[model samples]
Target: MHSRRHPIRNAILVIVGFVALAGEVGAADLVAPSVQKTLEASFSAKGQATLARLAQDKTQGLCTHYATSPIPAKVVTEITAMGFATIKYPADGEYLGDWQRGEQIAQSGLGKQSSDDVEKPAGGNCYACHELTKAEIAHGNLGPSLYHYGKLHGDNDVVKKYTWGKIYNAEAFTACSSMPRFGHKGILTAAQMKDLMSLLFDPRSPVNQ
Candidate 1:
């Protein structure tokens, strides 16, 4: 009799193979003359998408370098320092805004593509990686569930500042983080960051409930 095949094990093996391939063909390999020529021939920048976007920043470069392995502690520290230096707190000392608008922003998944309207404001699309409220059942598990973020993290000044920095640039807290640097990359405005703070910290917001 033939032994039974484990589907999950097979799937994991396939994933491992792909990851190995990616490790061999690291992101830097894409910069090769032949690869660059092929990419240039295949894809073209349009609208908000520019050729400059193809170039990797220091943080992204490090992440790509260590894509297959864990980033060294020293490198992580360097990345964290680089990210921390980029944070700019609100000038008005106000860190909260309309929670309603925040909710809207969190739910929306628009902007930042070549096709997106340059005039319209961008959205955080927070729900894509977090479960913010009980009503919205649709959410992803790539990141931790933030259902009771304010309740768990508290609403103190220290917590407020930390949260703001994390939102502005997640790499500051955890180097090579998959989370976007919202404020650092100009993906969201100061007012929008304040609004997200309100959504996470305001007692009346559904996120806290």
Candidate 2:
């Protein structure tokens, strides 16, 4: 005897198939101009944050495209090169600083918001995405756990330069890293970055312990 097909099951299957197809079709479509217009109308410039934040630079545009689809090798190379080239190394030629100060900078998550005082210095916010010291139990792990970073790697020239560059602009190493461009974007001052570096590399620092 032949089994009879349920009409409700058939209808549900058809609806699911149509939904999947519509999703695929919608994936390639650009964001609606109306949405952009709405954002522009709603968002007001405040303090350090400005309307220019809405505009995507070359790297940002490429990153956005890569999120939706595969980015070409040449584009990735170009983006990385651009990021690397833009790094502004410390003019005084000092790379390390007080680990205590660095720890404070890394732990503090203040500055750059509209509510924050623009005159005050910005924080590194490194602890937000990395595990720096054993003492700090409240740390995120979006990036690798950086505890004992210098102990494991040793304070070699290569390690020092790479650490500096990574903190300066994470995108220089990774095309679409979630880590902020701390130094390049002026999120943290050179002195603040040096302090964070010390926190990472200093043998006396709690991170090394």
Candidate 3:
């Protein structure tokens, strides 16, 4: 009588082989220079947006270089220092603006598109990732929910500074935060950031509710 092999064991061996093959394929894909060339050929600069956008900045390039692992402590410190140096605080020392306008900005997902007018201001699109208000049911969980932000942390000076830094350059807090570096990348103006702060901290704002 022949000994029969277990079907489950056979299946597991096949799966392992497939996984190893996929890993090899993925490694080969990264080595293909034509991939970058194809991407470059596909995208053309239009309006305020340029082909240069395809190129990563220093911080971005560094992050990409260390994608498979945690960034080194020294590099993290350097990046944070560079980001912190770029922050421009309000001249009058005011850090809060109209929460109502902020709500509108957060809700509106318009601006910064290739067809959009560059002369006009941009929207924050904060609601795209954060659940700011209890009324808004639709939100992505890419970032942590900021609902009751002020209620939980209070509007203290330390909290205010941390909020500003986080908004200005999220990478300042988390080395690889998915949250857009709104202020640091010039995605949002300082005034717009102040308005967002009000929305996060204002007692009357639905975020606080």
Best by lDDT: 1
TM-scores, one per candidate:
0.83, 0.81, 0.80
Best by TM-score: 1
For candidate 2, which ten residues in a row score worst on lDDT? 22-31
Model 2 spans > 4 angstroms off: 1-35
What stretches of model 3 exceed 4 Å from their correct place? 1-37
- What tens digits encode model 2's per-residue C-alpha lDDT throughout 1-209? 12365644443333334433433223223234454455566679988788777665666655655664566787678778988997887788778999999999998888877788889888888888889998888999998999999899998878888899999998888887788888888899889899998999999999999
Q: Which order, best to worst by TM-score?
A: 1, 2, 3
Candidate order by lDDT, highest to lowest?
A: 1, 2, 3
Report the C-alpha lDDT of model 1 over 43-127, residue by residue, as the tens digit: 5899998877766676876675666678889888988999999999999989999989999999988888899998999999999
- Candidates' C-alpha lDDT: 0.82, 0.77, 0.76
